[model samples]
Target: TVKPPVETVEVSPPETPLIPPEKERAPSEKVTPPLEVEERKEVEKQKEEEIEVEVSREEKEEEGKGELKRRPEEALERKAPERRFSIKTIFSPLTTITESIRKRKRRTTALEEVGPPLVKPKRVPRTLKEELPPADWRVLKEYEVRGGVAMIRIYLDPETSNYIYWVIEPPLSDVEKDNLKRLKDLLQVSLPYSLEAVEEERREKFLLEHLDKVMEDYRIKMSENSLEKVRYYIVRDFLGFNKIDPIMHDPHVEDISCDGPGIPIYLYHRDYGSIKTNVAFPTDEELDGFVVSLAQKCRKTISVANPILDATLPNGSRLNATYGREVTTRGSSFTIRKFREEPLTVVDLVENNTMSADMAAHFWLAVQYGESMIFAGGTASGKTSTMNAISIFIPPSSKIISIEDTREVNLPHENWIAGITRGGAEAERPGDIGMYDLLRAALRQRPEYVIVGEVRGKETMTMFQAMATGHTTYSTMHADSVKSIVYRLENPPIGIPRVLIQALNLVAIHKQLKVKEKRVRRITELVEIIDIEPTTLEIVTNQVFRWNPRTDTFVYGGHSNLYEKIMDMEDLSRDEVLEERDRRAEIISWMVKNGVRKFWDVARVVGEYYEDPHRTLSIIEKNPEVEGNPLEVFERAAEKGRKEHLKAKSVAA
Candidate 1:
């Protein structure tokens, strides 16, 4: 009554239902479709067959003969399951079925549009030929320095006929140079002003960190190769000797001489004589700055007010520099006699043909007997080197004192005192400690041996007095002959009495001259100071060994005053003393043959011989090279002896 009996209307069903009613049927039962559905299924089945046939024909064409072909039965089997699944799909929602059809079409279209995948070929790397060294120069040798960051190429210029020490470092690109400029500016502001206290190794680490920070802050994009190149330049300029850093690292270089600005730097190579280098200060300003820095490294100050600087660098190399044009005409000048880390030994002298083994053995005997001697030579004549080398011959137990203006004397003796002269701030040298003071203090200390680096001033008198007082004093002087040494000692600056000159036992005159077009250092004359002739009041000297220039060999004089002294001291005959000298010579020869040239290694050998002569000789009888480090055997023997002595002492206690 309310809605006209609900309008009793019936709704008819459509041709397809979303969810079809399931009829109970056996598992093997098959369902047949209506006419139009059967026709549609047949149309789909024909399309699928056509697609399969097309795929099979393409595959057969690709595989060619003897390849397996797809069978129709297998294709039918695979499609049968797909056809069965389609029936269930028919009852699916219209939206879902339409979405699936769209997806299939999209996949087909995408595949057709994309076609075959494109593969990019690898890029071929370019082979860059290294730039050839200058055509005018012939390369004598090329060796790496600075941990392989730089190379040293020694070239011979045929036109000029001069050897050039060329330093080859990594070439920086324009971008890298710009980055370096910015980074250096940033580092200069960030780093502390005084890095003198910082260790060399730590300074490099700090520099690397600062470089990284600068790059990050400015967002500098640089490749690792470029970064490394930039770092090398920074370290070389900041921590090292700038353009001359590579030359400094070369072990073969003995001296670096910078005459003036704009002049090619000259190097004294151990084998190649004095040679010009590719490195130079192109401007006076740069050379002045370098000279100032060198003075600072020596803990000294140099300015136009104080033009001359004579100081020792931290590495023990002697430095003599002039600050400005006020003194040096060209500009600033500097001379650096580089110090050798591994000091030359007696064995080294023999190996380098600087001296004969016989002379070294004679020095060995003289050093043992505490004979006072002086090495006289000009500048850079290797007088100091000879003294240092022969000093190893001093008995291991002797109390020795070495006094020098610079720290040049290095010894292996445990009971040794090394004294260096201290310069004063004022011109008068108010708080100065000179060699004279050091010599006096050394006398009070009661040293058996006194080594004076050089005798050029009042200290020569004190040294002679020390010699007279039975202190075996050795020194070096600027003299080429015995008479010159006497004259220099007895002159105004160093006025030693004629009698006092007799206290000196030996005088070694060293000279540097060319032999076979190569520079060589030779002990021109080994003269022994016998005594002062009463009639003429002149010093007497006996030539023990003389260098024959024509033969390039040392000639032995028939007799040596040193041998006579040794015989008198040991109460031995002349023949016996000569035999002992020969034995020592043989030992030095053995060391040279076995390449035992290190300072400590030679010291160990000499010390062992001093402790027990027969044992050292017996050990040498065997092939030391075959047995490995001769030091190990000596050390073990020494250790065993020490243990035995300690045990005996304990028992006694």
Candidate 2:
């Protein structure tokens, strides 16, 4: 039968196209819209030859019974073009369909949908064992089950908090303990070396080397529970600390302390102050073994004769342990003050509201101009972090010499000399280099800046002498307030003449506070030392900044004495110095706005700023994506610098 001419359908273009706004438009200008517009024209031209198709009643019925994943081809043609389908690309889905003569196959078939509603193969959940830490703690990873109780690691979740706490694992059942003993014996012959002898690099390799063979040989017929316990035991013993590996990985834990056996482990969390964990040793023997293993990892011997042990771990965390209750009264115990490889930056301090942008700006001016500053605070008050953050302001080219009991100060400057003190029984030869020795050596190196980790003993005298000779000194001291700083310096052991105290120009006291349940660290007092009072022998201090707890803000203490001193030394006016301060502040503010908080990244930016201040500042000024004052941050800083420059020239006349 002859059919009257078939009519083609004209499709409309979407209101919005799929192409990027500028990249597609920039080249041809009119090329983007033509695809949508021309496709309609092409379809309408072929309308006289177009043919329509029909579906059978049986097929339609089957499709209706099951859920349809895709719409009809006509509907697909309508929606697909609006999204990803680019008309120009010859290989596009729409292009393939429109170009082909054969009928398109349906994505979902009727037989396929009806054939046993597909069982979604269940996802194998992560076996709920503890996470394997990246470090090795092999001192006593493997154990034989002599008693009924076997230590099984279980992950704990505090019902009130989102944090997953790994507590002292609950004891295993009698049957489970027997399984662990059998598993240990099966794997015992294969182990090449003890945990202590296995190097850090070889620990992971050793565990993994034997893992597959052990599983294939022993894990084939084992139950999931028995298999899981064996795996946890293997990992806990080889790769991580039996009970505290999870705590070792926790970034929030500042300090981890174990007070002998049978007592709860205490942790000084950065935000929570002191939190007693659920993990503790059941026996003194177990505790002693762990402590000895830890000491071996630190490469130190802890004995009854040498009960007081202080050493550094492989990861650079500080370790202090006391054995035999000779001094600590508790059995062998340890307290590790976790070390941060990456130091805190100025941006971190500002974003946390520890210090204001202006106060930080003032600090920048002071640091650049060789101001001797000291961070004073109580224990765990963020004094070192504050000092480390602020030290970034020191000219990147300046030669810095850092002396510490144990290596701590990490600087980005290439011109840095690090000196660490060594003593105790190890100094039996009478030639162990102490902090005093390092300080004296640092001076002969002719460093522009001297950083003492902390001034405790005779080293205090040497540090003060360095400060007196125009070397910009930065140190941390254990003191509550600015007055206490003078007292500590003038007293015996540290015994500095009261007249020499004026050498210290800045004392920034950081404090740990509890505003509402949460622990916050902030600088409560920032003082500028005017001079030592000749008449009273008391320190003449001008309060430059004080933290306001009520508003959670920093109140600027008038203008700035340190800033004035900087201007005088640099031979610039008040306005010029203010401009310089603002300029430095804006650079820091820009960094905070962006996420340049890492020590190396922050140092890189600071180094670039030193190379070309205007270029660096302009790059920040032009980027609209970065958040800050924008007009105020740049214009005010630039204007102030220019004005100050003019004032300096006018005064020069």
Candidate 3:
């Protein structure tokens, strides 16, 4: 509050009327009385009243000496006798100036005890909220990423409406930046010329040697509050994804891209859709330098001759970048398809309308029984993510191996071996580990399930052969339709003789579509391969499930050739297999309802269910957060089995 400026009574000083100048003055001017007789009498009366009030105050002070000794507060509340003569002089506003000063100090201390001023104060950093706030910046949400939590925000630009942004908290300090530069120089000095060409995996080993000392030196230079920031930025810039690392960690960001220098970084946001960001590469030279650094991190290099680069980040994000203006007029550019650290589970897909619960339940049944499936989709159609999510349906104890050009498949199974194809000068050499090489090696490993990240070339044949050998295969191919999938398989480079192609049982066509103006990827069609004509090599297919674009719903043909194949393989009656599927579906529904979305949590539930179904059901059934019957799977199954038993008994009678 603006304090009233030292409250004081208005006092009129006695005015002096000017006499006429000597030249103009008449003899009568000297004789005239100054200020009139009435004014003089009034002034005299005011003086007398003031004198009387002072005398009264003196008398009261003498009488209250005993009270003042007992209670100091009482003196502040005391009223003086000068109500009419309330003019305040510096000497005596009310008795001693010292007493007045004490009272003012006490009131000021009380005002401060409550809170700061009501008006917007200067920016100040607090433990939680910031002291200083710019007019525009507003944080929309905060979420944890790999190394640190990130803040996602939106703000109106002068021209544009709003732009989405991702920034990590505990921002890096200047000293840390200096430390990072020093560390990078030190790293280059320590490595041999040959070792410098090594891939990201090996570079990590090289950097690890001096990381402790580097961190200690950085830590010593930073303030106590800045220690965490130092660590975060160090990991983020050097060990993590660098400038893009903040957005890469955001689970909501599906894609992170920088078009070129002077262009803002754009992120495809899960909630708000695509939005331009504040992050930008300031110049071509600077961007090229960063891209070169990114290449080295990926264990690759970019130059005028090798201007294009494609690689995977340590976190599994796909990086497609270009160096210099040789490729195009625009400066260096990069697009990163950020991979979620915790790959989505079946619950995530069902909730997202990418596929229905019934579809997931079917996948669960088929996958568990070792039925091979091929997920085909256009680019950015969520082929790999769906493949990863459904892989959770595989029994936890099963040994699984995943092969890819980039390591994208995330499995919960402990016995899983993830493989990525090698690149650079040694790629075609005998020591090279390509996708086909990895697949051949994986077969020897005798894995129960083999996952191929993507098949675009010669590796496609090996993947199908792996499936033909009774290895339950999970792989993705870039094909929009089942017919297209066959063509790609039978065509050159991927040349699987049409006969060997029939080994692939199911073809799930996943695609992105606009529903109600919003983009969503759904299983547009699911086809079961029944036969390949012996004479004509004509592929026969059973269209089991398809998405109805008009209704934005999945059409599941309840009967599947694959499921029938499952019946023959598992040696179980149809009802028993169906019951198992329903039970798994129920477990998934329970988890989705209870907010168990994390991959680890979903994996735990599936593993626990495998160990003890009833115990898992009981755990869910007892959870108060789960509404209705969490044990519906068991209850309904028991009822169905009991009815079947009664029918059998009646037949015997």
lDDT of 2 at 67: 20
Candidates ranked by TM-score: 1, 2, 3
Candidate 3 TM-score versus the reference: 0.64
Residue range 497-539, candidate 3, lDDT tens digits = 8889888888889888788877788998888889977788799
Cα TM-score of candidate 1: 0.76
Local distance difference test, per candidate? 0.76, 0.67, 0.67
Clashing pairs in 3: 123-132, 124-131, 124-132
* Superposition-based RMSD of candidate 2 using all C-alpha atoms, in angstroms: 26.5
Report how far off residue 92 is in candidate 1 (Å).
Answer: 80
Give me candidate 2's TM-score against the actual structure: 0.67
lDDT of 2 by residue, 389-427 (tens): 888877877898888776667788889888777763124
Error of 2 at 309 (Å): 1.4
Worst 10 residues of 3 by lDDT: 105-114
